[model samples]
Target: MNKTDLLKSIIERLEIDLDMIQRAAQTAYETATAEENIAENKYDTLSLEASYLATGQARRMEEIRQACKAYQQLTMRDYDPERGIQISNLVQLEDAQGNQQLLFLGPEAAGLQIGTGPSKVTVITPRSPLGQQLLGKFEGDEITLVLGNGRQVQEVVSAW
Candidate 1:
């Protein structure tokens, strides 16, 4: 799997999500301002509820827009294994059974997953536990990951 192509795919997916979020935010704002949503009775809070919902949706839309920008600005360059792990690097990890998972170190979009088949990759941030452990690590190095009640060893098969 090509790292640059996968990064482009993730950016494209984020763009699609941003468009959907914008539409939803606009619809929510319109509904909140519609006359039908006004509080007609003493016990009613329809307008207030709608306003809150619209505000939350608008905030989410802004967040997604910013995330799109961040992803777009990412430099799709190959990482030198000698330089160690860093953001914008794609790391391939192998477990005891030889199972592999591709992870992309990103500035944001920590939980986003992109691609399919062997190209599938998950975005991780430096703040994440696994990401923290992988930073400054080199290929052929092994690290023990503690997750909840279990521990597993993962080897840095490659990074680029």
Candidate 2:
């Protein structure tokens, strides 16, 4: 689906904070618009040199719009944990170092220490490298994670 469709799906499935998204989008839009206005001399801000910056600022505003559209689309996906590896699933895993890390893949704000409620679940987005490696891996699976200096280790602890 397109970005708007994806956003709708995300809103339906995940426990996201809508206010945060709205605030960020608005702030970005406003900042971009203000910069554009200043650059174009639409408002009393700077010298003629300011207009040159407006074009770049306008482009930034479009970038923000595109990002919003993309993020909106993302909110509209199936968040089933008991299915194929996806952003909505909580993947409790340990790398080869035996260090267990809990990942909760939700909207940006949802990444913070979320609760363990009925609708709440840890998440790991499939787009991430670690998340990609965990896909299709079942319990008791052994894997390696590459870290600094090309060092790799086998994950032993498989507890969730």
| 39-97 per-residue lDDT for model 2 (tens digits) | 55466555343444545555545644553454455543343335443554444556554
Clashing pairs in 1: none
Clashes of 1: 0
Candidate 1 residues 1-160, lDDT tens each? 7877887888898889888988887877887888887878878877777678889988888887887898888877677766798988999999999999999998887889997788789999899999999989999999899988999999999998
After superposing candidate 2, which stretches have Cα over 4 Å from the reference? 1-17, 24-89, 95-97, 104-122, 154-160
- lDDT, residue 89, model 2: 41
Task: Report the CA-based lDDT of candidate 1 relative to the real structure.
Answer: 0.86
* TM-score of model 1 (CA atoms): 0.90
TM-score to true structure, per model: 0.90, 0.43
Model 1 alpha-carbon drift over 4 Å, by segment: none
